[model samples]
Target: MRRFRARRRQEPTNQMRYSSATDVPQVVPPPIEAAAGRVTESERRTSSQRFRGDIQGLRAVAVLAVLGFHTGMPLLSGGFVGVDVFFVISGFLITGLIDREIGRTGRLRLSRFWARRVRRLLPATAVVLVTVGAMTLLVLPMTRWSSVAWDIATSALYVVNWRLADQSVSYLASDDAPSPVQHYWSLAVEEQFYIVWPLMILLVLWLQRRYRLPLTRAMLTGIAAIGVPSFIWSIVLTKTSPGPAYFVSTTRLWELAIGGALAILAHRIPRLPAVWAHLLGVAGLTAIVLAVVTFDAATPFPGIAALVPTLGAAAVIAAGTVGRRTISDLVLDTPIMRDIGTLSYSLYLWHWPLLIGAAAMWGEDNELPVTIAVTVVGFSVVPAWLTHRLVEAPIHRAKVFVRLPGWAAVLGVVCTAIGVATAVIVSLAVPKQPSYAVGGEAPGAAVLDAIPAQDPDGRPADSVDLLVPDVLAAREDLATLGGEPCISELEGTELEACSYGPEDADVTMALVGDSKAHQWLPAFQRIADERGWRILTYLKSACPLARVDIKYEDRANQDCAEYNETRYDRLHELESIDYVVTSQVASQAYLGPNESQREQTDAMVEDLRRTWTGLEDAGRQVIVLVDNPNPEHEVIECVAEHGDELSACAFPRAIGAERGGAPAQLAALEGLDGVSSVDVNDYICPGDMCPAVIGNVLIYRRGSHLTATYVDSLTPRLDEALIAAMR
Candidate 1:
């Protein structure tokens, strides 16, 4: 299933008591309150220094948004923004703790602080990791074991955010099953922030000591120094690449910095008038509520759009500086709200796994129906409560862990090792086998190509228990161009001039378009090697040769069309001696937003025709290879699940054709002379039915991209098509 397309997951707070987790930690005990007229030393402290129950209320609000979003509650469509809320809260809490500690004491005790964090955060995290590890082994199929195992291990190591961020940018893994621990990315970000912020605080403190600078000014300056560039990058990167930008710490640091800045400013300014504070609080709540209801997965996140929620969270915290007399505290600090806030971290950790695991059990990765989703989240509370009571609270309050920071450090190491060990053990449990090579045993596409299946869907009756490429290994079966990846990255149109042919060959041909064009590389390379023709490959992921907008990952990918602009222009300059062959995987789903799919298809076809016409005008004979059939779901997983009944993976030809680029290819080629097109549907989907496996070969790999081994098997047919086009 597409990972988190319908919802977003966040785990930011380290569950502890309100005083320990989010309150402005007074360096000393017994916080002083001002009398009716006179006051305590203004420089010594600030207002709202007591345990802020409202911050806990903010946690409750954020986690509720998370619950609503994950459970497919329509009102919380933009619930993913909850992560920003948590980040802001965490920033305020942690930065205040550090700043206050340093202000009172000459030195900041890093070891004790880290120990406190570890004791508070690690036990529950480790428990969840072990639970997920156990679930993967016992509940999930062997096909998902490896990926999820690594995910668990990384979560244990607090690096899954990086793992997820990298995968988010990757085309091959984009549509794969999400890790149950995917929500841990926020925790990872916080952990990394935890590591960095102290150093930053120390630097700020050092600058104050060195230059005799004012502490508040230095702190604010330090926050601005880190936060300004980060916010700028967040905005820029979100526009071009939203996936990584969402998970990467650099893109999200500004939210935390905003909170830090608020903390410092709160101390410097006098407490706000009650009416203004209440107004600010109400406006802040309104901003957060507006974002939760109105924003969606399509909204560019943690960028300029993110400012609404992050600043709103900051606004709420800032308003709280007036000390709970305000309207926000009235609603936010009710017993139930504060109680939920106390349990929020555990709730965040437990909810996603239960939801994902239950869905995985039911053979789905998409958002569950609202009723069921809500039921699952509701069910999650039992474990969340149990964990909070049993694991989180006891360890957090333990003085043994607190006084002896080394013991807490050791406990963290042990927990981390347990997570890693679980991953290794689970990985070992999965059966390992070398992939089947195309030979007498695995004929791949050869058997069906030799004799078309008499059966309605050309599924040759094979009595093999195991498929060639292992089910788990199928998605990574990407075709290579020359010696490099044929498709350029999603963000850039930088094409490599990788030539595939004998160097002495006089005839030069180029294979161009999106990854659909890349899938035919093996066949074309075989043809080039045999027929003595030089072929150049220019392929970009989701970028077609057409000049139309594309909607990928549910957002309008302006980059794809913009990349095409630069690419098609450069294609005009590649006055290479001869032919330019191309294909596309573009479907109605991939086309830019329009009132109707027909209009989108027509506009796409027009642009595709224009693109092809230009290539033809450049003295290059163009051969458009008709795109292949696409199944609604990935086939290998189905193949794995129903090894005894492979027919479960077959789909109707009509459905497959509509999902592929065949209709668009046919339309673009119509009424055009000198340009030839070839349809391999007879081989790919025989007798009006498309089967997942044809002639012992898995037809599709990632998304609709054809497997190299299968494409290799169709070499002779593609050679004939190329020859016919030349004729």
Candidate 2:
């Protein structure tokens, strides 16, 4: 009786008897009878299911791997595969429960099932969201608050996955720091599956009953219908757009479907011999461990690579279902494992925000202490245990939900909705102080005239009001070409030449290179307007005008190289072009392999020399505006956090000018005809230090690019340099 048995009854529920006085003979069809018998058996087996310790243990392993990966353990770099394991387990358990429900009753209780899910998940989730919202405001910079608030709101509504997918693709948002609530994206994916899967099952069950199809066969067909296409799409999108593919529900559905398939066919699967079961379980465990160690950030993920761990998890589950005790079952069935498994959901929810909050409080450069990390993880258990005991346990134990009046249930739902809406409103309503004055005298003219005497170490005595109501918005204003169609973006259409300045100006000057070159456009545009000169701009994001090939995110930038070549050829053909101005992030240059910093710098200088010499040879005057000091962190973010005392955010001139300065430019322009190099390093860095604010203006918008407001202040200085270089 304790032995595992299939859920089939030996006898049919209803029997047909032959009548003694029969005008017509009564016949029993064997096929119809057998089908009826099978359905009855399935129903019986479904009602007598036992708890699976192996599944609970599997949950423990999955959560541990995820926790390790998130804690930045180098050995568990690929532990993200744990999510795949979780998906499979979820699929198996949820499908099993639903199948049993359908077997016992003719219809699925959609409302009751969903209510259980909401009660189990939402209460704890809302608490985490609220806690994260408060922490984000207190610990993180105001610059991040707006985004974090929206993320929290979306996480509460269980749609953060789509938001994350959108953000992953946005170039502007690419450099944004991770949110405290970012882990909720995974929960969002699972919640979405919960919403759609039951309806799908309902449809399948209805079809099976109406069409006289076998229940198991019908369910398998439905699962395959969704799973197969999803798997194929996952492969396609992972190759083409890995960022979005990684987080989206569609790409991840097949992983869950694998578990569902196993659950549906559990009865049909043959039991393995003891030796084979042990071997399979061990192999499954090995595969999971191997994936965690071997896979890294560079690995093309969740594509063919994902099959390793998913199949491994599937194998372990399958092994546990049959034969003698498997290695996985033995290892995973311990009391501690079961307890951790019970607390897995809450642990998953609590750990991420704590880790992210730690990083935000202490900058990323300073790793959280191992002891502190352990302590924090330990502390997370307090909340996890409390949440499980106080919220989750009570909800599951109370069958009163089923007996509650419909109006009472409706009121509970309404109240929950109101609570979530209120949290969102409160998060969004947090006020930010305005820092920068808008509509002042021309920032460039004012700063240039007012810059105080340099300190003994060469730092400027004057501090600028870089802090604004919105620093990012002000930084966006720095680029006159923010939305210009001609500025090529990644995957943009064919490049077109763009022109600015006076339409009928006699003299033509060209500004060309990456975004760094584009940043100088506002200053040059002002010069052009003042002097009746035509300005032609050829700029692209992350693409330098240098002759050397560039690499981004470990891939060769073929588009950048091609654009540079084509643009160079076009520049040669432009007869009216007199002056060619160029600048770029000098440190980004890729010299061959194993090159030291000096060697790379030298190689970059040589590339610049070749490009500038070509321009001069073509009867064009070359003016190289030396790239600005590169700050190691976002200047605006620092200014936002430390606006009252901007010096706290200042970096030494030695570090700021490490990449770009007079040395590199002079080396490139040496002995070159019709070419000149100009640098305002003295003004930019002041002396020993480069402060975030200079002369009441924010110096840099992001890290290196001068804020348009700051650049406006530098026009008088820049004009003198440009006029001298041209002469």
Candidate 3:
């Protein structure tokens, strides 16, 4: 766009300035067959419409920011908000199309509209799903294969967002590997929204005809009816339940609605002056940049915090429709930006999987070298461009779909099935967990615990080739007492103690602490069953028995404190629960900020001593079960990838035990009244090296936690230690 003081001046047309369908071309929806559920709509634009280069440029910025974040660029830590930007853009474009369609036809041709969407989005998505499925088998660990398979199926049907939302809050799922198709969540949300938004508009139109109401006013009312409740729910859920809040559709509905409302009224509101448009555009761009740089993984999202980017995107869109030249014209309307924007959807789909594959192959996470990062980014564009040229563009613009949308519907089902089939194949390949333990002379600790010179049965470490539990099945190898979890969930504040052994046993023991204590139940349960002793377990995720100022989920964890206090009161009041045992995953516990490692260790030890002394005062004999060695990261995942060379994954015991709280637990009990400490780590590691597998059993699961089978092997040693500590 340009302005001149000379003769003639050419200015951009505000294409959104339509009051009636007569002002725009009528949409010709293709014929279609299938109906969708709680519809999730793909992005759509009106045919033969005026080109808004500024909007395309905005799309470029959004994708680039996301790419920057995914490709190991720390500067754009908050760039994940690019998905929010896309939602606003989708809402505005789709709503305008709906309003225009109703104006011309007096009704929505839903099947035809769905047909067009299918042809436009499904082909590219299915192609990516198949490619990712093959990649998963070739590169990723088999443990990840089954989940990624489900991810593919859900993504194909545009429901991965719901799946991710469910998983986000599950304590069991928190440590699972990230699926390559995780980014499809945003697409799922949009599709689900489009399904409902159109129906609401149709209802509003029906009411408008009966009441003689202005169409725009009725639509605005409809927008508010959905948007307001969603915004309030977003805030509440974000504060109390941040995990699910990030991925759920209900929390994000308001952002799209804001875009829809703007599309309806942008023409009605007076256009901004050129100078004001420039300033507003600059402001919006600046706001987006600031958000991209500042926000991080710990940032509570899709709540009130979302307003900055969503509103900033809205401002840019609003400011861009000024007809006169603005600051956005100089930045957003370039040829390069428009070209990238045209391939944006494909780029979004392809980039994440490529990055994930890169991580599996050579990188731990997003810590790739600059050269590797640039290569991955460059390669991602190749597939995006190829997909656009061969699949997305051709199928979307094809004449056959224009004539027969019914075929498009059929093709969409087949495409979705291909993704489901991929999932089924992967599921079928998942190695079943053997009911009985599978290799050596009661292997694991016995070999390692042997005195090197005297023990004839001891074999060299990592000698066992055949694994007891297969790598894929090791995920289910959880520590259990009577087939139930010992720990309460991350959000749980209750003191619901699970009882084990006989109800009328003469000896009653209480086990209290976090997941670290939960991991010991397999061995403890054996000890209880043999000794005819009853056990009461009070455990919570990340809530150690230590009375420390713990932080979780980016805030002060009042729940941990509340639960610990409740547990203390119960132990004090109950005379029957005379014996107490506890341990913690100290390195895993997130303490307050700005503290050195030594400072944190001191604080944790002090808290532990204080907590156990209280137990001693209650006349309860206290035994601190020493925490296991922390491999610091996922050792099972490492084993799965390098199963043949098991020794490669073996970490040093000294380092792991330090990372765990072995030293801290001992320090807490040093000369403290009635409090005794028991260490079974010698049986666990038994030497300088912490073998990834011992006695053919996998030692770690997803995190640093020990496998139940391995813990079961330590039962006799653990029982001996407990008896000694009791005396």
Could you give the C-alpha RMSD of every candidate to the true structure, in order shown? 3.9, 10.9, 8.7
Work out the TM-score per prediction. 0.91, 0.82, 0.87
lDDT accuracy of residue 481 in candidate 1: 61
Better of 1 and 2 by TM-score: 1
Give the residue spans of candidate 2 off by over 4 A: 1-48, 206-214, 364-375, 405-429, 436-446, 449-478, 482-498, 501-514, 531-582, 586-625, 659-678
lDDT of 3 by residue, 78-185 (tens): 777787888788787777666556544567887777776677777888898988988988888777878888888898888887787777655577567678888787
> Residue pairs in steric clash, candidate 3?
31-405, 39-191, 40-191, 40-192, 41-191, 444-695
Tens-place lDDT digits, model 2, residues 1-727: 1111100011000000000011011111111122345546543443234345666677778778777666556577677778888888777666766765665565678777776666567777766777787787678776667777777767777787788778665545544667777777777778888888888888887798899887678888899988899899999877766667777889888988997887776654334577776887888888888988877554566778888888888888777766246688888777888788788888888887786677666544324655555566678999889977886667645667657534335544653575366457646655544556555433433443544435454343444443432464644554673245345664332566788766667889988877778777767767877888888888776677777766444334556778888888877878789888888774545554345668767776788888888877888888888877888777777877776667777888787777544456667777876688778766777657777766556677765777766675667788888888876
**Candidate 1: minimum summed lDDT over ten consecutive residues — where?**
28-37
Error of 1 at 342 (Å): 1.8
- Model 1 TM-score relative to the real fold: 0.91
Going through the candidates in the order shown, the clash numbers are 0, 10, 6
| Candidates sorted on lDDT, descending | 1, 3, 2
Clashes of 1: 0
Q: Which candidate would rank higher by lDDT, 2 or 3?
A: 3
Q: Tens digits of per-residue lDDT for model 1 on 70-179?
A: 77676777887787888898887777666555545556899988887888888888899889888888776677788988898898999888887787767676556667
